[model samples]
Structure formats: C-alpha cells, structure tokens
Target chain A: MSATATIYLLTAAAVFGIGVYGLLQARQILRQLLAINLMGGATFLLLITLGGGADGPPDPVPQAMVLTGIVIAVSATAFALALLVKLQDATGSSDLDPPDAE
Target chain B: MIALAMDAIIAIGLVWLALRTVRGANVFSAIIMFIVFGLIMSLAWARLHAPDLALAEAAIGAGITGALLLVTWRRLQVLEGSVPQVGAETRSLWLTLPTGLAAALLIAGLGWVALSLPAEPATAGELAWQRLPEMGVSNPVTGVLLGFRAYDTLLEMGVLLAAWLGAQVVASEHRPGALPGPAHEEVPLVGALLSLVVPISLLVAVYLLQAGGSAPGGAFQGGAVLAAGGVLLCLTGRLEAADQASLIERVVLILGLAVFSGVGLVMLPLGEPMLAMPGVWAIYLIETALLLSIALTLVLLFAAAPGLRRRL
Candidate 1:
C-alpha cells in the first residue's frame, strides 16, 4: 500500500516536470494552455497522495478539495479558451508575441 | 503483485500521455492528448481512494475541458496557416532540467516522509468522520463540501461566476453571432446524435446531484454533466449562441448565489452563522439550487453566448 502511494506520487511529479518543460518550450498559446492544465492535474495528484493514510480509509477532506479544484480547473480553462479565441480573432496570430515579430 | 503492476501501468501511461500532449505535432493532436491525460488522471484518482475526485475529474476535468479545448482548436483552424517553427529559442541544461529535477527530488522526499509519518494524532479528518452522522449525509466528502464547509463551497461557486463575468468583460464589443467555421448545420447526423446524448447527460447530471447527498456526487459533478449535455447541443447546432443574454439566462446564472445569500440573510436575524444551513432540509434545498445554477452557468459559459435557443 505504501509502495503504491510512492508510485503515484512519483508519476505525478514526472507529469508536473513534463508540463513545466512544455510550458517553457511552448511557442503556441494553445500548447501552453494544455501544459498549464497538465500542471494543475499534477498538483491535484500531489495533494491526494500527500493526504494518504496507511491503514484507515483515505482523508475525505483532501478528496473534497481536489474535487473542487477539478471543477474550478475546467471553469478556468473554458474562460481561457474563450480568451484564446478572442485573441486569435483580434490579432490573427495564436502566438502572444507582438505583431512586429512576424 | 497484481496491484503493483496495475499501478505501474497506469502511472506510466499517464506520464506518457502527458508527454505526448506537449509534443503532439499539431494543435488538434495536442488537445486530444490532453483529454486522454485528463481521463488517465481520473483513473489515478480512483486508485488513490478518491471516487469523488474521480467522478469530478472524469466529468469536469476530462469531459467538459475536452469540449472546450476542441472548440478552441476548431476556432484556431480558421486562422490563415502559419508555417510551424520548431525551436525559436532554447534554454541551457543548467536553466531548464535542473529546476525540473529539483522539483522531482522535493516531491519524492515529501512523499516518502508523508508515508513514514506515524499518523496525525488528532486530525480534522478524524473529527470529520466522528461528526459525519450529524451532517446527515452518507458521503463524508459531500458532507464536507456542502455541510460543514459550505462556506468554501459557496465561495467556489462565486469564483466560477466571477470567471464567467470576467470572460464577458473581455469579450469583443461586436460579439460574433456564430463562430465562423461551418455553422452547426453542416455536421452529419449531428441532430440525431444530440437528441440521444443531451437528455441522457441531463439525466445523469440529476442522478449525480441526488446521489451526491449520499454518495460520490454533488452539485459540481451534476453541473458538469449538465454542461456536457449543453455542449452536445451546441456542437450539433440544436442550440445556437446568442449575442444578448436572455432574461431567463440571467436569472438562472444568479440563482445559486441568490438562494444562498437569501438563506444566509434570513437566518441572520435568528443570530445563526451567516450561510449556516438551518437543518438537513435546508441543506438539500440549497444544494438543489446550487446544482441548477451551476448547471446553467456552465452551459452558458460553454456556449460562449449569453443565451441559447432551440434550433429552427
């Protein structure tokens, strides 16, 4: 059981690292959005793993919080996507850099 | 042994999907990969002993978020094609890899220590368990969200509302009546598909809400499910986006907040805590209202329009 938790945590950490690397390299706004979401998922995983219990059932508090975080993530993402669409329409470029760069 | 293997497989798959999401050759594939990553994360939540989290992740994280991403991807396609540039800028190994490695090390150390710690001698979780019966909810997670910590839940709803408002503020003055790419009419068999999916999703949303009082479901989960149904309608052209928010849309958007604030105000004279649920009945009543308002808000947000109308 303890070992299972460790594997989960490590997996989450690796995902977080990959998301961060992607965020760094992402030249497109859409890819960066996906990376940010991946990072959020990793953080949720980290919270749940950290709140694990060895014997009794897992903590309900963290579970509830993570649940809230998931919904909030989607809401934020939806708004962000809307912003992306509006931005693309305004500038004709999905990349956020200045128009002069083109 | 089997458990370990299952864990290993799922974990590796999740990381792989995350990597692919970042590295996918095109924006469309990257969005697809991100959706898969969300689904895998949902399964991981279940394995971590969090069915509530799993349900929310699958419904909201993977399902609704996927819809939003795909919609954005389609919108992006309209832009005149720009040649892809692979690496305009590169960071030194000293700059990038080390921060990632350090984050991993810190997380690993924290997990090991967390596992080794004997136990919380007296934790809020223990207290929550002991008080669960008093909350009159079978699901401890639900109880915490809507009963004991109702304040936080209320504020979360506010955050969602605020996000919608912020989006509206940033919206262009001449909001596009309908998105440019093929109006919903051009899709093949979309009507029949939506007729089936929309109702079923709504039913599931209601069930999730009702069951939430006693199980691994709640307003947020139910609302997301409902939003999914709306997404299907929008995709199929059964529902059209509107420039001006309808009167009814505005009412439903504020229903949850209104009901919540009303309850708190009504109870204030009695000298109870603001927003303190008077009893189990009040809890259910508020949850129902919250569920409805949340569902409507999510659907409205997804439509990216003020109102929706049945297809002509």
Candidate 2:
C-alpha cells in the first residue's frame, strides 16, 4: 500500500478505538451517540482507503455507499435526538441511568 | 512530499478530534468538537479524491448534524432549567478498561486484514466501470446508484421517509415550530442576505442535479444544498412547523419514492426486471423526484415537525 493509505488506515484504527472507548465510557446518551458517529466515520475512511488504494481514480462504488451511509447516519441521528428530547422531557435528565442508581 | 505531510496532519487531527469529541470537558464542548471533526473529515475526503463525499460530509455530516446537536442541547437546557455538564459523572474504570482494550484489538485486527489484502484485486467497482456505458450516465457513482444498485438507492429513500415518520412519532407535545432565533428585524442586511442566499442555493442545487449526469454532483448533494436553504429560512424565522402538513407538502414529501417505484414497477408488464430504468429520461425523472423528496425530508427532520409552513 502507499504510505498515505497506510497512514490513513492506521488513523482509522486509532479513531475506531477512540470511538469504542467513548461509547463505553460516556454517561450521557448524546455522548454515546457522538461516539457511535465517530466509529461510523472511521469505518467510512477505512472503506474508502481500501477502495482508492495508491493510484488511479478512486472507486465510485464505495463512494456511493459512503454517500448513502452519510444520509442514513444523519437520519438515524436525527431520530435518536428526537428520542433523546422526549427522554429528557419525560425523565428530566439526559443521562441513561436513573438518578436513584447512584 | 507536501501532500503526504498534509495527509499525515489530517490523520492526526481526525484522531485527536475524535478523542476530544468523546472526552471533552462538557457536553457543549464535545458537540462543538464533533462538528469540527466533521469539517476536518470532509477535508480528508477531498484529499482522498472523493469530491462528492466531501460535499456530502460538509453539508450533511457537519452542517445539518451540528445544527441538530446544538438544537438538542438547547432543548436539554430548557428542560432542566440549566445547561447540563456532560462528563460530570465518572464511570468505574474496571468496566471501561477491558471494553476499550477489546475494541482496540478488534480495530487493530480489522486494520491488519485491510492492509494485508492484495493490491488491485478485481472488485465490483471495476465491474461497474466496465458496464458504465449501458447505464447512460457519465458519472460512475451516479450510474451505480441509479442503475446498477438501484435497489440500495430505492431502499435508502424508504429509510429517509421512515426516519422522518419516526421523528414525527417521537416528537413531544411541544407543537414543533420555528426555533427561537435572532429575529433581527432591525438589521437591513438580514433581508438582503436571505434574498441573495436562497436564490443562489436554489441555482446551485439545480446545477448540481443537472451536472450529475457527467460530473461528481448528484441528487443527494443537490438535495442537501437545497435543504441548507430551507434550514436557513427556518433559522431566520421565515418558516415554521405546522400541526398538519398541507396537501402539497404531503404529496411532495412522497414524490421521490412514488415516482421511483412507480416507474420501476411499470416496467414489469413489459417484461423488464424490477428497478431497471428504461432510459436517461426515466433516470432524470426519478432523480428529480428524489432531489425534492430528500430536500424536504431533511428539512423536516431538522425542523422536527409533522409539517412546515411559511411564517407570516
């Protein structure tokens, strides 16, 4: 692989790891959502890197897939936020855990 | 050499921003960092030679998502009567360490496999390129989306519609309406800005739709640009959510899926395969419908309403 691709692949790996950590460690549902999105971004980068390789025009198949994925991600995010708003309205807290748990 | 250096910097920035977005001092900061992450990732897409993706990432990933996040944060503040501090409560490290380590190992393994794959292996991408002429679209991505993988594109529209419906279901009894924004009637520039920006965005969206036949633009990108205009109007209080959708709004909302599946299924009695568009005309028809539907769907999602109306 080209050095550029290698560098990006490694970056993707690291970002994925960070996302995983965030998802595990976050207390707030919104924070977890952000982490999930981070993980999704990492996967997109990795997929495109794999498709593009070192030279020639980048592949369109993966590009189209990523485009679709981006739209889907936003849709899911918006729905999740809507759910989050309702959760906050009902429970008066953004955290997933109930107050009595502590 | 300089290009390599730029890539390295972007890679580092992405990793850093991802970390910060997760571990920032507060929820507000984390959200901001996430937006910044989206912006930088778009730059990375450009560097990776995917201009279509770059445009999508900047507009949808960063712009719309960031706006949604900020709005949610504001809502949380309103509910609690104060800005909630994220990351204030600490979790036990014992549970975190093993999970984090396992995830890191999993990613490392995936990366190793990705790197170990042979270079230039024949892929569906190559096949799509070979068959591009039959699709009648010069843009390979557009060809794959509308022609070769039309099923995926079709389902994606369903997903968008489903999401909007889901949002409407989950929306609280707040009577979704225009978000309280700076209604600066005193600023003469606001009117000038709207007059210029809205029309320009419309022009750009049309140009993108037309260009998709031969270039990097397409229905999704054009739709996003158009939605940005709607979002601008919402922010400036030119638009507001209504309790019920107007008849025109309801029809336009379903136009994409309706036109797409209508044309696709109509080919069945003629003995053509499902979703096999007849010609360039059919492709443009579906795409135009898709552009309108996508723009409306996204704007409604951002607005979090069953319907929208002009603010008088």
Candidate 3:
C-alpha cells in the first residue's frame, strides 16, 4: 500500500474505534444513529482506500458500491427517524429501553 | 507533500468531529457536528479521486440526512417540550476500559491487514475498467452502477421504496401540516427566493443527470439536489400534506422503480441479461425516471407526509 492508502487505512481503523465507543455509550436512539453512521463512513473509507490509492485510475467498483451504500444509509436513516418521531408521539419518550426497566 | 498535508488535516477533522458528535451531551449540537463531519468526508472523497462519491456525500450524506435529523429533533421537541435522552454519561470504567482495549486491538489487526494488501493486485476493478467502453458510458463509476452492477442498483431502489413504505406504515398519524412548515404560505421574500433557487436547482439537477454519462454526476446526486428544492417549498409552507396521494405524486414516487424493473423484465423476453442497458440512450432514460422517483421519495420522507399538495 502507498502512503495515502496507509494514512487512510489507519484513519479508518481509528474512526471505527471511536464509533464503537460512541455506540456503546449512547442510550439515545439519535446518538446511536450518529455513531452507527460514523462506523458506516469508516467502512466506506476503508473500502475505497483499499480499492485504489490517490494516483492512477481509481477503482469504479468500490465507488459504485459506496454510492449505493450512501443512498441506502439515507433511506435507513429516514425510516429510523420516522420510528423515533412516532415513538415520541405515542409514549412521549424516545428512549430505547423500557419504562419498567428503570 | 501538500496532498499529504491535506489528507492528514481531513483525517484528523473527521475523527475529531466524530468524537464531538458522540460525546456531546447536547443532542442538537451533536447532530450538527455529524453533519459537518459529513461535509469533511466529502472533501476526503474528492481527495481520493472519487468525484462522484464527493457529490453523493455532499448532497445525500450531509444535505438530506442533516435535514432529516433536524426535522426529527423538532418533532421530538414539540412532543416532549424538551429532548429526551437515556444512558449513562459514560459506561462504567470496567466496561469502558475493556471496550477500549478491544477496539484498539481489533483496529491494530485490521490496520496491519490493510497495510499488507498487494499494491497492484488484479481485481474486478481492472476488468470493469477494460469493458467500460462497451457499457455505453464514458464514466466508469456510472457505467458500473448503471450497467455492470445494475442488479445492486435495482435492489437499492427497492430498498429505498421499502423504507418509505415502512415509515408510512409505522407513522402514528397522517396529520397534515404537522411538520414545522411556516403557518402562512405567503411569507415575503420566500417567493423571490424560490423563484431563484428552484430554477437553479432544476437546471443543476438536469445538468447532473446529463453529465452522469460522462462525468461525476448521476441520478442519485441529481435527485438529492432536486429533492432540496421540494424541501425548500415544503419548509416555507408552499407544499402542504394531503390525506391521499394525488395521481401525479403517486406516479412520480414509483417512476424510478417501475422504469428500472420494467426495462429489466422486458429485456428478459429478448434473452438479454436482466437490467442490461439496451444502449446508451436507455441509461439516460432510466436515470431520468430514477431522478424523479428519488427526488419525490426524499421530499416525501422529509415532509413526513402521506401525500403533498401545492398551496397556491
């Protein structure tokens, strides 16, 4: 791997680690969503960086896959936000854990 | 040297923003941080020579997703009179330490693997690059998305449609005007703004659609840009929710999925592989419908409405 790829690969791993930390610590659904997106971004970065480096003909396959992935992430986020709003509407709370669990 | 510096800056920025997004106790600020993180990520994409991804990340990843997050935040605020949050400020030291240890170890292993990958290994990318000319598109990325891996694109459209359907089903009510759109449709200066922005976005979206055949633009990016216009109209109260979808709205929402699958099935009878582009022209045709479908779907999702009506 080239220097650029090396930089991104390490960066991706670090970012993924941060995402994991966030996911474990978050109880709010929205924060959890943000954490998950961070992980997703890291994964995409790793995929593209591994596919090719800064120079030469960039790989199209991984680029296309990441494009598809970006769209998928948005759609999933939309649905999740809808669920969050509806949960708040029905129960006046957006917490994931049950009320009795406390 | 300069390129490396830029990359380093972007990498540090992404990690920092992600850190802020997750660690901040305030939800609003955290969401804003995440949006900014997306913007920087787009720059990183451009640095990587994936201009198409840069556009997609800017429009879809940052633009649409931020709007969704902010809108949901508004809804929660209205319902609860304040935001609701649950969870410990941080996991206990015992749990956190172990989590940290595990993450570092895993990442170290992954980093080693990534560093060890052969620099110039033969792969499908080389094959795709070779046959790109036959795919009837000049842009290899678009060619792959529109031709070589069309089945994936088809399934992604299906996923978008399914997600919208699921949201509609689970939504508690179809309350029209429930969103935080302005109370009055005729807010001053808003009309002038729309006249300017709407047309520009329209031009840009179509230009992007046309450019996808040879450049970095595509149906997804164009559609997301187009959706921004509709979102503007809805936010200003120009578009209101309706109890039932109008004929045009219904057709527009399904246009992409229908056109894509229709072409695929039609080709089956002719003994062509499914979703094979008949020619260059078919790619453009499918992209236009997809542009419309994706635009309408995103706007509908943003509005959180069953249907939409233009308020005159």
TM-score of chain A for the candidates in order shown: 0.90, 0.95, 0.90
Model 3: per-residue lDDT, tens digit, B1-312? 998999999989998898898887688899999999999999999999999999999999999999999988888888777453555644568877787788778778877887787776638899998999997789998999988899999899989988889888887764421676585656678889999999999999999999999999999999999999989888988898777788998898889989988887777778888887888888898999999999989999998887889876
List model 1 lDDT by residue over B242-297, tens digit each.
77778888888888888877876777889887876677777777778888888877
Question: Looking at model 1 chain A, which ten-residue stretch has the lowest summed lDDT?
Answer: A93-102
Which tens-of-lDDT digit does each residue in A1-102 have in candidate 2?
688899888888888888988888888899999999999999999889888833577888988999999989998998898888888877777796767566
Winner by DockQ between candidate 3 and candidate 2: 3
The best-first sequence of candidates by lDDT reads 3, 2, 1
What is the descending DockQ order?
3, 2, 1
The clash count for each model shown is 0, 0, 0
Model 3, B41: alpha-carbon shift in Å?
0.5
- What TM-score against the true fold does each predicted structure earn? 0.89, 0.94, 0.94
Instruction: Write candidate 2's Cα lDDT for B1-312 as tens digits.
Output: 999999999999998999899889888999999999999999999988888888889988998899889888877776777644443454777976787779779778877877787776647899999999998989988998898888889999999999889888877776432366554664778789999999998999999999988987889989999999998888888888788788988998999999999989988999999999899999999999999999999989888777889877
Off by over 4 Å in 2: B82-107, B176-178, B181-186
TM-score of 3: 0.94
